[model samples]
Target: MKSKTLLILTGHTKGLGHAILDQFLSLESVQVVALSRSSLDLDLPNVTEFPLDLSDLNALEANLTKFFPKEESFDRYILINNAGWIGEVKQVGKLNPKGIQRVMNLNLLAPMILTDAFV
Candidate 1:
């Protein structure tokens, strides 16, 4: 069997991410680490789940450091940014600032922070 790899997957609790996780968890070479808004009932053998809110970049970074410290760099690191949201679809003039901000924060900002943390 190939050596195990540390895989970090965001948005893994539903949709495409969920399917990917399902496929990878069966592989002996992959150690899956999933981050989702709520705990999921995935009973894969080599999978670890983290209840996370990706909107909080600082907390995400801190937790990443705690989970994958410098000393644990031997395993491969993979981050999938699949979380996204669509705010009120209205004319520009009628757009809600708060709604747009929340969507951007979750879709764009969180991915950027994850990329930085991975690097």
Candidate 2:
């Protein structure tokens, strides 16, 4: 049987993304596209991994073609925007400006960017 849906899941190497990936693995009708900074420890045949640093907006945009090729077609597309980053926990005054930007870029901007590209 052919895959009927394409699932683009971010942050697949850990936490919530990892759990979601495990569940998706059992579904034979869905093809998974996982993006993460590190490769998944499990070598599942149904999943395709795209190693990416989502926090790097420029790089992410530059690599969009490789992840989302225009030639590939799916009956449906599901994007799980699970990628996020919580920078060092401390008093607001102690937070470094660069660190704050990184957190926002990963936790906020990255999702919108990916969604835009997906659409």
Candidate 3:
């Protein structure tokens, strides 16, 4: 039988994202499309790894098109936007603007673009 649900996860190699990926894989009806800045070592049969920086919109869009082509459309798409930062220096003004921008790019902007594309 074919899987109808598609699970898109960020930071798939570690942390909350990895845990979510693990749970998703356990469910029989979902196809896990694990996204990360680098490739994950999970190597599960139901999981397809799409390593991406997410910060790069052009590359992300292109890769999304290639990976999630319309011909293989998912009935239900799950976007787990779990990639984020908790402040670089762990302080208010001490936070690096560049680092903040990187966080925003990965955490917020990438998801928004991918959401628009998914719809």
lDDT of each: 0.76, 0.87, 0.76
Better of 1 and 2 by TM-score: 2
Residues 1-119 of candidate 3 have per-residue lDDT tens digits of 56589777778788888778777878877877777888866667668888788877778877877556455656688877777665466668687888888777877888898788766
Clashing residue pairs, candidate 2?
none
Candidate 2 per-residue lDDT over residues 19-107, each given as its tens digit: 99989899988778899999965577668898898989998898877766466678889999998888899996899998998899899
TM-score per model over all chains: 0.81, 0.89, 0.79
> After superposing candidate 3, which stretches have Cα over 4 Å from the reference?
1-3, 90-95
Off by over 4 Å in 2: 1-3, 69-71
Rank ordering of all candidates by lDDT, starting from the highest: 2, 3, 1
Model 3 lDDT at residue 41: 69
TM-score: which candidate is best? 2
Total clashing pairs in model 2 = 0
What is the Cα root-mean-square deviation between model 3 and the actual structure? 2.5
Of the candidates numbered 1 and 3, which has the greater TM-score value?
1
Q: Point to the candidate with the largest lDDT.
A: 2
Inter-residue clash pairs, candidate 3: none
